[model samples]
Target: MAPPAWTTRPNAKDDLRERARELRRQHRSVPEVAAELGIAKSTAYRWVRDIPLDVDARKALFAREHSSTTGHGQMMAEARWSEYRAERDARQAERVTGAAGSVGGLTQEELVRIGAMMYWCEGAKAKPWNSTRRITFVNSDAGLILVFLAFLRAVGVEQSTIDFRVQIHETADADAAVRWWAAKVGADRTIFRRTSLKRHNPKTVRYNTGADYHGCLIVSVRRSRAIYDMVEGLVIGVVRAAGRPSAPCDPWPQ
Candidate 1:
């Protein structure tokens, strides 16, 4: 039999065309066949355009194209979301700053009330089952710690009687944290009890890492038996004053 038409061509074009067609028949994509054969995609497609893909081949092509397009679209969406988040965060910050400005210096009574409420939420309390008045507060927030100190001062609690130490994971920079806490709370290193080191857990994924992580400060006022009762009274007063009218209780004792 006479050789097929393409074998008589003077150059490799005939071989490339046949190879491109063979790849297309084997379900290879136009770009893949063009790349292997060193031909333009358009030229590859022109050669293989008449080759019909079966249902599975069409589905595979669709999946590949969809995956590429979806990936590109997702990246664009993430970029837009990042921009939106920054703008939203900035606007929220402005509102927060404005709201903060509305609050001027707190009065002694206000501090007492605020501190009592704050302590009730985060501080150790004496339960009815086992009653012992011990005033202890632990927190990681610097602002709360500072406010609590102010509250103690307003209530006439001497600073000397207060005991403080940091509680942190053993993996953290314990020395740096101690120094940071000393400067932050205006306390001497000599005063703080030995820091409480938590044993590290290999299974845990900890997010509270980095230079800013100073660990939680544990503050306990020695000889606080009386102060505990006073705080309890202050918290009760606030509850009575702010209590809703629905509950049948004697109108807060005058």
Candidate 2:
């Protein structure tokens, strides 16, 4: 027993707590600090429970890990492509310099009109009595929210203006899902409103969690013109990026 006591090590919780305190002092995140110290995320959380943090430590951590060097690389790539687009647009504009009086091809006004039409047709909600200035899409698929958000941004809608709400079954993991989506879009949880849907039959097969859940997001446009233009650019830019030709069509084609 004495030999076994000699071989045993003392509890290191105090050491871990001290290290965690130091990391917090240096503005290190719980997850990063945990990873560095070979501890669990929960342990890190517990250690920092009593400590006060000026900013959201968890989010700060996630952004540092996910949006650091990799995010910069992607941004640089996008910037290079944007420059190429500007050059191409200038060349195209030069070609149509003679047709300035007429709205012929690849003009700024034409682009704006095209973008408006595209947003009206695809993104905006249409009703028999009135066309609501909102975009509604159905999905039970996972990760669609992120895709939709990216699309909105591509079309010119600022992330700040976008709102999100989740419609889920009453018994489902609605809270968890909302948290996950919030983290994904880098948006605050307050932006999400959880609604309950009653299921009459309890025996029916349904996806309750993970990627299989059947849920949809209600996306609304507070600024219609801006949203429309953004969407139009997104469509044209995507088509051009794919090396395909896209012509603007009528909003209410006969």
Candidate 3:
């Protein structure tokens, strides 16, 4: 092919075209080869436009360039994902820490009120037909059990008066659970009643397996008729107080 009008020397123009042809054989694009050889892209294209690249060479070139761009995209995506996870974790930590700190400086009166509310929710209540009101508190959380024990202690219920038992799935470690509970409540393991096992159902899949799965503890107060009455009265008082209407708000300006 004839070189551009700017090139008057035939030998130098032939050398340029030869060099451009070698670059194209090595899978370089026309524009890239032209830029490197200090020639116009149009001249480079005209020189090698009819020269077909081998199928293998074309595929290899595409793979090489595609791999580079794909690697860059992967790195960019990974960096963004890491940044998002870090931001989310920091935000969650801040919220959790703030919430934990806000509950600090709780007075005895406040704890008592909170305990009563917890009892109202979780403790056994007296039904109209079955009027056997007892101080039976069942829970899976050790912290809650400890808190309830504290409330009982504050209200003058001795450790000897409280009965302990474990209610767990038949698949769990009942002995270990009972021992753990006894230690937590500052009671003897021998004092704990026999472990209550819920028969395993083959049809159901249970998630409460592993080391963290210590079954629910049943805390029953011995001869707690008076204590039960007090708890019921306290709950009744709270309900009545909550039901009362608040003072009316003043009307807004027209």
Candidate 4:
């Protein structure tokens, strides 16, 4: 005898509901439960949606299933950051060590040459008509300034020849700059002409306070040739010191 059609179809609604309930109780994901039971994920979700579970119960279930995931992700990120930091630290250490090594090798002649260039380029003011030879430098950076004055003493520019030293600067704190330079170089302030003060305006974009301002001293020599020769020699000396062999010639050899 053939079985009844209703029996053969096998009523699945009750079975599906019971399975969904069991899955939710066991803390299995809805998608995982659906896949195991051969049903649509939406259908599995709908089966369990009407059931009430407390927030604490849901939180406990989530913690049990995915506790290791957070730790694993954090460890991966930390490992990557550690590698980057180590590489950065190594490069910085190499630079510091290399700089120290170079400094120990510098000769007295090289030091004097460095002082001369520093004065010419960084300390001195350039006039439009006269080249850097007619330029004037302030005794600002104490170490370099001392070295430069020693070089000047060696070259024999006498006290009388060091005539009419003055400072040309903006009106704000011009006097302070002059005083600072005079004290540093052991020169008489009486020999200094009055500070050349420039007019200031509110609309001026020059926000420079000139606080680090050591105003330049105009060391007017009797013969310009000696000053010019010193400046030219400084350029050639600096190039050689840097290990770049450059042909010695005055850039403006007049």
Candidate 1 TM-score, C-alpha based: 0.68
The parts of candidate 1 lying over 4 Å away from their true place are: 1-71, 244-254
Index of the highest-TM-score prediction:
1
Q: List model 1 lDDT by residue over 166-217, tens digit each.
A: 9999999998898899999998988989999999999999999998889999
Of the candidates shown, which would achieve the greatest lDDT relative to the real structure? Answer: 1
lDDT string, candidate 3, 107-201, tens digits? 77766767778898999988999898789999999999999988888778988888899999999898999888888888889999989999999
Worst 10 residues of 2 by lDDT: 244-253
For 166-209, candidate 2 gives per-residue lDDT tens digits of: 66776767777677656766878897655546554678876455
* Model 3, TM vs. native: 0.63
Per-prediction TM-score to the true structure, in the order listed: 0.68, 0.38, 0.63, 0.44
lDDT of all predictions, in order shown? 0.88, 0.63, 0.85, 0.65
| Per-prediction CA RMSD (Å) | 13.1, 23.1, 12.5, 16.1
